[model samples]
Target: MGASFEQRPQPWVTNISIDDIHSRDFLAISKIHGRWGGFETLEKWVCGAYAGYTAVCLRDSEGKLWVGESRHDNEQGAGATEVQYSNGDNAIFVLFLSLRGEDVIAVLPWDEWWEFELNKDDSNPHIALLPLHPDMRAKFNETAAWKYAQSMNGKPYGYHNMLFSWIGTINANYPPLLDAHVVASVMTVCNQMQPAYAANMWNEALNKRLGTEVPSYSICNCLAWDLPDLIVKTEMRGSSFAELLTIPEQDDWVYSDGRSASCVAFVLEIYKAARLFDPISRSIQVTEFTIKDAYSLRFFENNSSRLPKWCNDGDDVEFLFCQIRGRYRMELPGYNTMDPYPHMNEMCPSLPPKYSRPSNCLKAFPMM
Candidate 1:
């Protein structure tokens, strides 16, 4: 029910140097095409197309991965940020925050996220403040950027709703205009870096390599390979056996129509992309994969790996999963709403210690 791409031999697979760690030439573009709806509408049609949604994840000078979505969320809706932070269940820090949740673009910081805000200004309307560890706030002034950020309290957060079809000298009340433009431009450039191939070609290759019965859910899994490779092209996310799923797209992990997980698909995807010659067959095996023994196929092994816990205090995916899957709902650590940020919120203690304390695990005292 959408546009299709052609599959061609990605000859560039041979050109990539697995040993080259610092090469900036290798860019990863993950096109998340889902049913968001509105690709082709007439008469002042807003770009809010459910035709699909796209997100381009790129790394910055600081080594932080910035994921920028194509569309902006509601001004009052907390869903995007809720999903972004996931109340600290997902190990990501929301670099961009605003009253309206205008953070179409979010930065997943390498270091722990602490509390701070660099208020809105003319150039950037969305608020830049976020929760940081209390101890780090004082040392924040040490940086020139921090000093300037703190000073941005008074400027108006300008916004402009931009569309490629439309031309303008329109006023700048639409802050998304700037945000969307920057993200779109960067995605365009990243996309251009890839060898010219139809989108369906990539999808077909991905499905064939993974032996996936359903490629739609598995396509999102490529982000596991795409993001980490772009981060350090030399290494894969987990390894040949395991990989890290950094982006927690609801479609891939949560929602499903009884599809198998996509871990083995990642192994094959990376194996072919890196152009490794199979020793036994002595040919580059991209389309076909075989194993000598059944014991070797442990599909569930490292597949449980997720980016990091980042659920918002109130937005409980566990509850939602239960409602949808019709399973018993499991309560996660308690939400310390009092904490400035959801990440800082303490997890309620488990009845008995099984493993090391859970993230932000609360210290429960014996009955007094």
Candidate 2:
């Protein structure tokens, strides 16, 4: 299933020149409207406002534009085993290839491609973003960015920690017809059916929290006999399910397959290497950044005057980059107001008490 664009919207920007965009700029692609992978769609519905895909722009010494993205085509695939590169001839090709033809187009620095391919087709659209702060923009180390990208080039996608990254609370992360109980029940079944897979999936994380060395094949047995006691004991120790379930992501931690970094995680880790989040947000765990959280970090160029003349020409909507297609309008929600908890997501401990877990979070238990 591809994205539907029957009522194509007006192009967000006009006469965009490749010269306007610079290296280290960011791109937050919107969620594909009608894609088959329900997981990303669910992420968009839950996180809101363009929580689909993210990639970084880099330029070589000769000043050729290249995109660095952690792309996982499907479950059966090798799983983002390398940092995918998309250049002039294959940028658009890779975009469609990665996203499975979602009615989206990528903008590159190629003038001929831009003029002939994009200008000729009004239905396809693209957007661009840059650092908002002059100091941060100046501090962007293109060398460091490339180096970091190269380092993690062959690491597997962070599928193991993906759910834990967003699921800070017991209830908030689940969409309709799903909750903590439902997740736990599904996990219990998975444990019974495929203990090793389930163990690698989450039991190891649970074992880490519980200070236990329970083996993978015995996980189902432990779930049946020991998990309830562990839950009760956890409550007795003054901890809640939320805290027990919240696994802090470690950059050095190697999973069963390999070191893991999701799409947004890969982007933020590159930003960390480039010193883009220096001075204040350097210590943040990149894995914790959802697509929404990453984009809302108040780092992107928001001022229209500072942007290209074409980017600023849109009258109906103020440009924070551009959204060329989508049923709903795009917004940056907490834009420029990312105070107190700048780099962390809404579920971070640094947030105020109001952001803490609900009372029910204390009472919740994993299904047996």
Candidate 3:
């Protein structure tokens, strides 16, 4: 019998490594600058983002998993600019190509991913891209997560749920697939200075109740007024986002109401559906630095001096970079601005009319 999207298989408890996927002679990509361009090419093609993302995972002979993040190593040297595009997709795609049918059915130890170091190097934070075993891929392919993600193949893309979905599937105890309005509400809580104002207005107008405080810096997306209810409904139905995915009319929940998914959310949903990590655990064993290393979206923007007081604490520089890079060309495009004044405030709408600038963009970055 063929496996359907809603099916959840028994967890494959066996642990595997990148070395197991590659031959004993395989070397880390960092050691070979000549090959970097090849990876960059693949990223430009598959990533489909103005700014790229980078994550690399390798396991040494000792079996210790070492991860690497894409750093800005352009003509200006390191930290001079933020990495606009990541080569992690290239690493993953290459690994998938290299593995033969013999490498199927294996699973990664779930704990390791959550436990990876963010600041592996004091100078540069890097998270390695760990490829899922063919078996795990097959396993994930049988799930609703996979089916729902696949349902979004060629739709118009939006940036709202991408970061939040990644954080939710990998970190939250349950799936964080929420409606766009819910996500907007969550963004309001995190982005507004008088956080209660937005929540109060939403409650009054929509006749709904939402959380007042930002629950965690870890949470980056919008949460529904009744997220717990949606989660419970999912548990009863056996799939979280599948129902939302099946909305055939191209409603407001999907980006552009075109019934599409963003690239990052699609990939992470594959990971979640594959059961790459324990969804129920939500332990988050990794350090603060490690989580930061793993994600491109800024989780520490609350601590950033460049952000305005009304901006979301979880707003990421990469998210802002994507917004800026998407529009309004800069002379030195690669230059990273420390003060995100006009651009920073442009994307946010949670702020009241008093806080809003002349340009009224309703969307903002995820909180985490």
TM-score of each: 0.19, 0.67, 0.23
lDDT of 2 at 102: 19
Per-residue CA lDDT of model 1 for 1-368, tens digit only, reads 12222222222112212222121111111112222222222101221111112222223334333332223333444432321222223334223334354323222221211111112111211111112222322322222321211222111121111111121112211123333345334534544575232112122222222333244545554432232233243233332211111111111221122211121122222222322222221222211111100011111112112211221112333211111100122221221122111211112211111211234322211111
Per-residue error (Å), model 2, residue 197? 4.9
Comparing 1 with 2 on TM-score, the higher-scoring candidate is 2
Clashes of 3: 26
Clashes of each: 39, 0, 26
Summing lDDT over every window of 10 consecutive residues in candidate 3, give the lowest-scoring window: 23-32
Of the candidates shown, which would achieve the greatest lDDT relative to the real structure? 2
How do the residues 77-108 of candidate 3 rate in per-residue lDDT, one tens digit apiece?
22111111113343221111112221111112
Candidate 2 TM-score, true structure as reference: 0.67
